[model samples]
Target: MKPFHHLYGPVPSRRLGRSLGIDLVPHKICTYDCIYCQIGKTTQKTLVRKEYVPVMEVIEEVERFLKEETSSIDYFSLSGSGEPTLHSKIRSVIEGIKEITSIPIAVITNGSLLYLEEVRQDLLYADVVLPSLDAVSSDAFLKINRPDEGLSAERMVEGLVQFRKIYKGQIWLEILFCRGINDHQDELIRMKEAINRIKPDQIHINTVVRPPSERWAVPLSQKEIEKIKNIFGDKASIISEFDRPPFSLTEGNIKEEILKILRRRPLSLNDLSEGMGIPTEELERHIQPLILKGSIEVRSFGESVFYEVVKEIQISRP
Candidate 1:
């Protein structure tokens, strides 16, 4: 077995179940340098979007994997490293994958670029768009998200509100609450107002769970998460931490393989590391090729960066 390269997990997700992620940007290249980010800081921050990786190569890898057997993947997610929308070729990539498979495609974004018509157009094809709105106030927004220049809380909100007018697919808006930061009564009220305007299909309330970039970042108690959820009504729910034991893999497949390990539930990086005894650095290297090819992606809950495969990429004989 070549080990599944260019893909990572059928990893468990808080929002999307059994998602396969597709990373289209370089590591940590995002518009925001969030304090609680799990993947660290934005080493290269910009609004520029271009083809960071070849779409054809990614499609080829996905083609090979789907040929073997259908795993438990539920989504072909556009996420990882930094922001997915920053990749200029995202539209082409999304369209290309759709030509091959009918798997529901999703894009996990920070909602920074939604103000741009181009950005909204690029995301229209996605079956679901999971965007983050951590704070409604600029002071708290800067304090928590640490976004790039010119990205204001008011401006970001406006973009989100506008995007909804045209987008027909599901919009699962996420709001990550950092204790003592954006998790106050006043802030939540403002967030509620914003949520009402956008009227997303789901309001995913999240907190810092893993090791965060800032030491002060803390996960909210179950009680606190519930309180916020109440404000949002039935569509709101606290994000549950997904945990699964890792599976042991053969030594030879350690480096090149991108195994979509069979699991009934979600798995974490610790599970994969401990279960396979693969060094963290080695595991990253194995997944790097996939990320570069736009076949895999990375996401963080706090300090932990989890990998998933992109399900949208499928190959067919002409």
Candidate 2:
């Protein structure tokens, strides 16, 4: 069976294995128009929180998925499309999931609203909160994230620090570095300072691997990534380029499975082939229908062609 509208995955995740992703906000509705954003630019860059999706609807889907499916879902990941915390009643969704199952909850956010006490309080029940911090300086923050006008790097860090103190779960702080932009010696030093304040349970370093919004958001070299690891010390780890195990597909529906995986983020044809263990020739049969049906679209990044679920009705292939 196809996944419910708001839910996707039980697809492979490097951080959370076989995660069932819940998309709260609409596509690209976020507080930051990050330069390196994989899903492209934020169409609605707002700090004003609202009920982007009905909390009860989200809860209903969660309940239904758990009751019907018997997939080995590792985490009930409350993340999809844009900012999840922006959903006004996200607390209810989190609490609702908790009421229904034993699966851990993860909220992947850009970490913009963590400065707000209400936001932090709402996320208190999560098993893990993966918040991102790509810049420490105002210039770098603006250049990299292009956050909502009032949202500054200092405020974001302050919120994260406060959350760390009160949060009872794991905080895997992610830092996305854009080469020559936020990966300089000075930037790393300032980043280390902010990281110390947050005191996250774990630190993750990530560079642009997938197709980013701007063509200029280049990937860093292995030597540079290793160097940053040294700078952040032991708690900091790089999100590996290597694929993780258990890309377990659903029982009988490959089409449903492909769309489910693509909805999370963009994946190259080879990425899909390698990760799903479907040969390129066989996978193309699946890909052809998805492309023809206007359910998914493709774009070229570096030397790879990446497929993503269509954001709008009109589809274009590159």
Candidate 3:
């Protein structure tokens, strides 16, 4: 299948196998200007939810992809650029996808907007909803998420609990933290109390593995993370690299796909490897020359390095 502009990454996911990412909102358009965000700062941080992308238009792209070619994708991920919930027509998109195929739908969100009944209702159709809760305290929330005026952390937590009570879906809550900020014993205990309210099926503990918008958003060590995992208990686990794609794309096409994706936005090595269905080792061989020739460059976002087009490459199809 040809690359769709709005559709990116049947990217390898650590938890959900190969995932086809559907970009509902434009780049960095989100509710939280999160300190640990891998993709960097938010350009529009708002509480307003609108039809960010035409829902029917994207459903058409999905139909084309599913009908034209076989995808090894385990799920269709409503995650790209920003929060999927902000797209007002996401419920329609989910419904439209259900009409086409039975593959499960997953949405990765910040959980900031989940407090709104409209937002929570819009996501009821999804099989999996992954939302993050980095801080439990108001002061910590402001320092971490940097949300808009009137957007309270307390309200967000209340919303999550309320949504959980009504919705019968998997809620895999993500907790992204940095050192000395929200990783202390007191902070961790408060987080546990807050998490109990949501009662997620799983607690995904992640850190700033990629370069973040804020340099101060440091990651906890593997040992430190594991120690905290014990405190958080059985449901808590670290999100790490899991399996490789079972298939591979033939030579020549891999580079084009990588270029096609990066032309839209920068991606980490793992993102490139997963999306292209190519091994990182082989991808590195092709990537090194592109970087050396000034076709692309590696940029660090936390500890993870991502590849983005150098902008002057004058991308004309060979």
Candidate 4:
């Protein structure tokens, strides 16, 4: 298997099956330099969406991996080192993948630019969309998300609400709460109202699980998480990270291929594209067979999407 630094995982996900990740943007090129970001602060923060990396390059990588005949992947996710939507070619990448495979396409994002019609249009082809809303109040939003100047809580929520109206695919809204930050009663109540307006298929309530940039960012206990889940009502659940069975990559030993890449660190689609030198369209082709055999899964961390090994079929080590 050709290794790339950009894409990581086919790691074990609590949500989607062993998933194949695609990173469309470069490192930390996001609109928000969130306080609790796992990848650290954004070095270049902007709302501009452009072709940071060649779209055809991403497509080729996907196809190559798919042709490798690996198994044990589920979703073909668009994510990575930075905000995916920031890449102007996002829509084309999605379209290219759709041409290559029938497996569900997922996009994990921060939802900052959903207010833009073009941004919403770019997301139209995805099977699932996961976005984050960390705070309801502007003060808390600035402190928690540390959004770019002029981005506000109301605007972000409005964007999500509008996306909810037109999007036909499954919407999973992620809420990452920081202890003593956005977890207060008033914030939770306000968040509940916003969620109602968006009406997503699932409400994924989470806290800091990985090493974060800010020391103040901490994971909520299961008990505390459950409490927050209760506030969101039945549509919500606390994300669990635990042991699962090995996912089977029936073709070309996909689990082995994905694991070889993930052994270094958690990676994104952009990571894979750059690392593998395979076009994104080709990458999608490589991932489709694996998804059918159930080797990978997809999960959410705020707006980020990650791939994990499925727990059923056992995969041999590469």
Best by TM-score: 3
Give residue 278's lDDT in candidate 1 (0 to 100).
59
Q: Positional deviation of 109 in candidate 3, in angstroms?
A: 0.6
Candidate 1: list runs displaced more than 4 Å: 1-6, 241-318
lDDT of 4: 0.75
Among residues 3 or more apart in sequence or in different chains, the pairs in candidate 2 whose N, CA or C atoms overlap within 3 Å are none
Q: What are the lDDT figures for the candidates, one per model? A: 0.75, 0.84, 0.83, 0.75
Q: Please count the clashing residue pairs in each candidate, in the order shown.
A: 11, 0, 5, 57
Worst 10 residues of 2 by lDDT: 309-318
Quick one: best lDDT, which candidate? 2
Error of 4 at 179 (Å): 0.7
Which runs of model 3 end up more than 4 angstroms from their true locations? 260-271, 300-305, 312-318
- Score candidate 4 by TM-score against the native: 0.78
Give the TM-score of each candidate: 0.78, 0.90, 0.92, 0.78
Per residue, candidate 4 scores C-alpha lDDT tens digits across 202-299 of 98888876546676786667788888898789999887543344443444544455555544344455444434444546656765555677655555
lDDT for model 1:
0.75
Model 4: which ten-residue window has the lowest total lDDT? Answer: 241-250
